[model samples]
Target: DHQGKGTTEPGVMHQEPYGSLLPFGLHKGYALATMCEILGGALSGGRTTHDETLVSCHDAIFNCMTTIIVNPEAFDAPAMQQEAEAFLSWVKRSPQSGDAPIQIPGEWEENNRLEREREGIPLDTNSWEKICQAALQAGMPEEELAAFRALAQ
Candidate 1:
């Protein structure tokens, strides 16, 4: 059920009945994946992971996700806010698995944004290289790029 003997194949971790254990257990993850395949793959015109369509540049097959935004004005603000706060409080009150305190979904992202605002965003070497490449392609002077790097440090 695989390709020829010597061919480099996908990692065993990605195979069915095994990959289901990656983040969530089989039952929940399998259902979520099925729904995503239906909505993101079948609904979107874009290619699904199973699609054999090949592009020369990359080996990864991509799926498109559909996002719908909800307007806050359509719902009760104060009452909903109260319920959300209560739920978060209840979740946090659960016994901790480790010394680190529990954080709600948006908390880490909000903290990161605040930290980056106060102290400039930190980019890894590869990301900084990409930024330099972009600036260079846009005709930025090498001297200015060097200065920018210096300022970043």
Candidate 2:
């Protein structure tokens, strides 16, 4: 488990979980997660998750990031753009396994963004009510909340 809820669905791996999640690819995934913890915590001089590092401690969280930056100019491939386009075209040409259309990398998010941009996001009544309640509980002025609610409607 990588401390997340188990699901076969894509695009939901980053969600906060209600329970532990199974690591992808089983042991190999577990190994990758272990390395991430090491690099993001110990190697980066940040604290790893523990009793003292709980999010509830101070209502703020600390994050450590490790990244690799590379310059495209450093590479010798003169036709990199065309090569990448060719590979992506080849992959997209393959038959999909299910009814859902094939999406490459950020395509799903981009599609959703465009749809939301055109249609606006749909929120169920229950969720909207809960958000209002939370704002009130957080000491929002009733008159201000009412103004915002009017705009939302």
Candidate 3:
């Protein structure tokens, strides 16, 4: 089972999972995510846990694999590479707000993940307090959490 959790700052597309679709076109994204559900559920006879209430709310998950079958030799490899590079260059050259630089798909997200790993996840004070309280309620020793807080400092 692949289980992971991530956080993203507000207004950043990479942090917003469904937000990327706006740039790529929402209809296209809907089609793509829908295709994932169909193939995972219908083709493989696997029920997409995203659709079931208990599974959706709790520990169940679904997986889908999408592949593009491309024959590089059918087209000029160098030409294709050049075209891709050109497109990326154009995107990078777009205007930016203040010190922010234009980034292509996955770039901003990778950078954010790396930065957060180094600096620690950014959570508001209230959320942090809530988490600590929850841990205490869950029977986590107060001394253990206090030690962790000391180390975190």
Candidate 4:
């Protein structure tokens, strides 16, 4: 919402329309991103935007990721699962917005996965064309691409 031309303060100079990309929670979000960069880049011994990697290719992009996995059972909080269930139930009890029912974090994604599995995934014509082009470029035979394209329809 804050990216648009009129979103900024009156005196503030706006960038391109909807061009301002701020962190999610302003300062807190910025701090979180910085922490991730340090952990992912420095700790992982991978290059951040500041550090140069793959000196042979100027156009190469590098990605560094850090995943932290914690077991809830390791904690002494016995009521954690119950409390989480109660919170999820409370959130689901809220009124629906428009035609869609209220959903928790992963509910929508799970439902979408199920639906797409039952019924094939949907793709627009433009995207399908681009996918076919990519397949052709990746050395897929024209006859094979046509067969897959037929199945898509």
Clash counts for the predictions, in order: 0, 2, 0, 0
Error of 3 at 118 (Å): 1.6
Candidate 4 local lDDT, 1-153, one digit each (tens):
334443545432342221334667765788887787688877778765441543343422357777789899899999999999999999888877698788888899999999999998999999999999999999999999999989988
Clashing pairs in 3: none
Error of 4 at 96 (Å): 5.1
The candidate scoring highest on TM-score is 1
Models ranked on TM-score: 1, 4, 2, 3
lDDT of each: 0.70, 0.75, 0.66, 0.73
For model 4, state the Cα shift of residue 105 in Å. 1.3
Query: Least lDDT summed over 10 consecutive residues: which range in candidate 1?
Result: 14-23
> How high is the lDDT of residue 64 in model 3?
43
Model 3: per-residue lDDT, tens digit, 23-104?
A: 1364577677677767766577666545363335443345545445788789757688789889999988987888878888
Residue pairs of candidate 1 with colliding backbone atoms: none
Q: Which regions of candidate 4 fall more than 4 Å away from where they truly are?
A: 1-66
Indicate the residue-level lDDT of 69 in model 4.
91
lDDT (tens digit, per residue) of candidate 2 on 1-153: 234545575544344432344667766788877787778877888866555655454322458877668787899999998998899889888897888877789999999999999988889989999999999999999999999889778
lDDT for each residue of candidate 1 in 93-152, tens digit (9 for 90 to 100): 999888977999889999999999999888899999899999999999999999998988
